[model samples]
Target: MVLIFLFSGIQAYAVDPEVPDSEEAISAGQSIFNANCKTCHRLDQKLIGPALRGVTDRRELAWIKQFITNSQVLVQGGDADAVALFKEFNNTVMPAHDFLSDGDLTNLLSYIEFGDKVDPAAAAAAAGAEGGEAASSGGGIPNEYLTIILVVLVIVLVLVLVVLGLIVSVLTKYMNKNDDLDEDDKAFINQKTDYKGIFKSDGMIIIVTAIVLAFVVKTAINGLYTVGVQQGYAPSQPIAYSHELHAGQYEIPCQYCHTGVEIGKSANIPSANICMNCHMHIQNVEGKDGISPEIAKIYDAVDNNKPIEWVRVHNLPDLAYFNHSQHVVVGGVECQTCHGPVEEMEVVSQYSALTMGWCIDCHRNTEIDTQGNEYYDKLVQLHSESSNDALKVKDIGGLECAKCHY
Candidate 1:
């Protein structure tokens, strides 16, 4: 009888009464997750944060609430679990979400519990409705209004100019008829006032030709210089790898797959082994009927002991030299600074021109981060002592020809 009672209690606890397993709650939770948590947390995979599918099951509800509300406070107070988590994640601090209401938190918890059970079609429909609602709520002046205003202004300016020309013509005629000017003098004045004839004169033509020739020469030179520059050159890769899904949605660090980024010359292409780390278990995508063909390619390569040939997107000239570690690690430059919004890209493409002028502009404008860098400490101190201006990349031989070229 005692054993039977204990089993009943276990069953009751499994189905909690406080957390409502409703579609509305799940949808609300999903929205919250996408907006806030999706950047660092994945449902079934470890990203910057731990997999949060069964987080509630692992920890008590009260403890979870406290940790989520203010993890730093808990860590500072010497809470064993919080400290352990902080240490485990290489001391990466979780941002506190104290602003989330109790109702919102409950909904988030409910979604975590029953999110896997929710039908994909239904979820998509709900998401579409929410997106439409958001679009409707976004209030701004339409492009049509601005275009109409510009057209009207141009028309008004043309009308004003025509009226001014007519006024000038009448004044000239009236002055010639009423004033004590001779017929020869009047004829000479009319000849001078012939705007069309003046425009068609040899002097005017020569000046215009010179200006045109200068513009054409400049344009041709610019075109020649940009012959090999492949800005926005997005080539189709062997696999349809979505950087948006991996980096943007899942918030995987750029350095995670590009292992050599912080230590080597090249930001090496991710090998099949790196893909296998996650794809070993997540064989199929969520909405797909079978294993994703793109993911399968990786598996096939690994099994057959072959390398996946990923096409290079961003390429520099053979003469130029670039080190990934120098910029990424030492200089503390963000990957997106050169690559653009890589997380938003469905198919990764060259976003920047990557021209000599572009690199020079970056070096001229970018300020070096001197804090915690022992190499730059002395240089920064000398500069600070010498002048009030902050030290930029150009100040430390960034623009030198040898810095980029061998």
Candidate 2:
């Protein structure tokens, strides 16, 4: 009993007499504290102000609310209790927040009462919104998947057609002899069996002629479609060059080897001097038992031991006038964009068809990075007014025949 009394005495001394015990009062205090008090005071740590971790344990909620509402007022009233606290906190005066509404104050207090607990409902709602956005942002379906589905559909259709054909053949063979058949039935029978030299018969001949005509028309259409097409053209080069090597392992910059990219029309093949730049140091290489065959070719080309013959890899037709700098430097296209991931290639072959259609398709999709270039300011303004964010090469006169031909 004596120890209990001692403990109670200490607790009584800690709490202010003015404070009240009420949930509403504590809630009201909390809202105001979060909005204003949170800027300086944390529940446990001394940020700019003293920690309020166990303030409720130390003082009555009512007293705390009174101090919160107006600490200066309590001090002015000669409240030794308030004065002592102000002195204890190094006379650091807590500011009054007159702007906070009663409801706002209540919410702030509720947060303090609950402390830190994850709200599952809020988390779930956020996750749902994120998932919905991700679903919306994705393209409808990948082409490969769509193609696979289409192929399966086609295969199913073909199987159905073949089965139907077989069924018709069997039915015709069985029913033709069994019928005192009608004219159409007899004709179908004749078509099916071709018995008694049906190929010599007029109707059968007409049907065959019609089929031959239809085949001819389809073939003509297909031939027209392929007039200027070169789908699988693999041209021979003078050099046994492997786009795979220089582009693949070494990651030699395309422009470094193709030095004429920025300054002139072609991404010209490196001269013997450029080859010597690296080859001089790399001669008698380590990889394949020294004396690298490829590097040796460069040495021979320089005529240190007679001029080496280098076959040309890419040769634009004389009729077409193309400028590498216009596309590479001005347009800002990487070599690999056209050449296709050459760094991974051992022997570089033309990845793109490089046809007019291919070029136009690329032009249609590519966007220009015109954010800060003063040269594009006028063009950008025009585009902004036109409501087109994408700037294709064609929009910048890239597709004009004169641009390529002249």
Candidate 3:
């Protein structure tokens, strides 16, 4: 009887047609999740929302569907589960996903269920092995080693030229001694070989003057170009913060610190409270002394109700009106597009020139991503109707002077 029951349970779990099984569905679900849900939900850990792993196992399929479709309606309807969940999350309302089809919801649920079943250690090991293989395959000679090789080659070439010059000089002197050339011819050869006198000639002076003037003009042009640009401007901050450690090693998201990136004009500097979120537990640095002095600075500020005076790295002119949300939330620009490889930076610096020309060039080149954004649907349709070519940002009002300056 126990064997019969076990067999029945296995059949029920395995034969569910609603459950997503294909790679295509899972990939689509992942894309959908990254576009819509990643700002709040994580698979194994909590962010703004609860950890989503095993969510399908915890809730009924019907209940999960309804909740995802319209949580506000469920809450207002006084559904016990919905109300309880809302209260548990400090009344943070889960946005309704009514636009998601039944298939999409099923796929998303399947991904969550599959994620819960995956062993973390095994996944990590697989990732590490893949990374090792990629590094081994793609790693070329280091730039420093290449530079050393080039220097050695140049020195060898210089030595060969010197030896050739000496040989030619010896041959000329031997020919002169043998009386193979006339006296006037010998004197002419001697005068031609006088490099010091040649350098002091009017022709050489003219060439030198032209070269110097060209260099001066080039330098002046470069100086003018860099007048207001602050690319690579790395300033020391009040506190020691390693973005490489936090963002790269620890895998923390950029949006976690710069909370305003998706909603406001600025990707605001994280407050001391935000620092305490992690540093409260992680007070000490690994492979170092007891408590990290750098982390202690955050604690001190929190204790004294003071804000850490973090130095601003990227800045824009007052005349330009750049909105963070417009680019990040609407345009869906990656943080790395403007910030460069910040995860690799020990100390963050201004990566882009942030000049008017830079902005114009980007606007001209960038294509509008109108996949899920309803706001661009009409604009995209209009553009397609007007032109057979792919719609770029410049096709819209992105290049208008008033859009940025005014």
Winner by lDDT: 1
lDDT of 2 at 311: 38
Instruction: Give the clashing pairs for model 3.
Output: none
C-alpha lDDT (0 to 100) for residue 69 of candidate 1: 80
Off by over 4 Å in 3: 1-229
Minimal lDDT window, size 10, model 3: 134-143
| Reference-based lDDT, each prediction | 0.80, 0.64, 0.78
Residue-level lDDT tens digits of model 2 in 1-406: 9568545533543443334324665566566665467655666555445566556666666566677777898888888889997886657577775565555544454445434333457778777655444333223554445567889999999999999989988887788778578998687676635467776899999999998999899889867754433333233333455666666666677778878899988777667787778766765436643344455456445544344444343555676776788778888888878777767754455566766677778777888877778998898788778875677677888678887675
Q: Once superposed on the true structure, which residue ranges of model 2 sit more than 4 Å away at CA?
A: 1-241, 285-290, 304-308
lDDT of 3 by residue, 1-406 (tens): 9568545533544334576656677677788777667656778766556788667667778888998898899899999988998997768677889999998898887666553344457899777665444433124553444567889999999999999999988877877787677888888666556789889999999999998999899889867755744778776677789999999999999999999999999989989998888876785777753355577577657655778877567777788999999899888899999999999999998898888889899989898888887888898899989898777888888889999996
lDDT score, candidate 1, position 300: 59
**lDDT digits (tens) for residues 2-40 of candidate 1:** 568545533533655666778899889889877767656
**Regarding TM-score, does 1 or 2 come out ahead?**
1
Report the Cα RMSD per candidate: 22.1, 27.8, 24.0
lDDT of 2 at 118: 30
Least well predicted 10-residue stretch by lDDT in candidate 1: 134-143
Residues forming the 10-long window of minimal summed lDDT in candidate 2 = 228-237
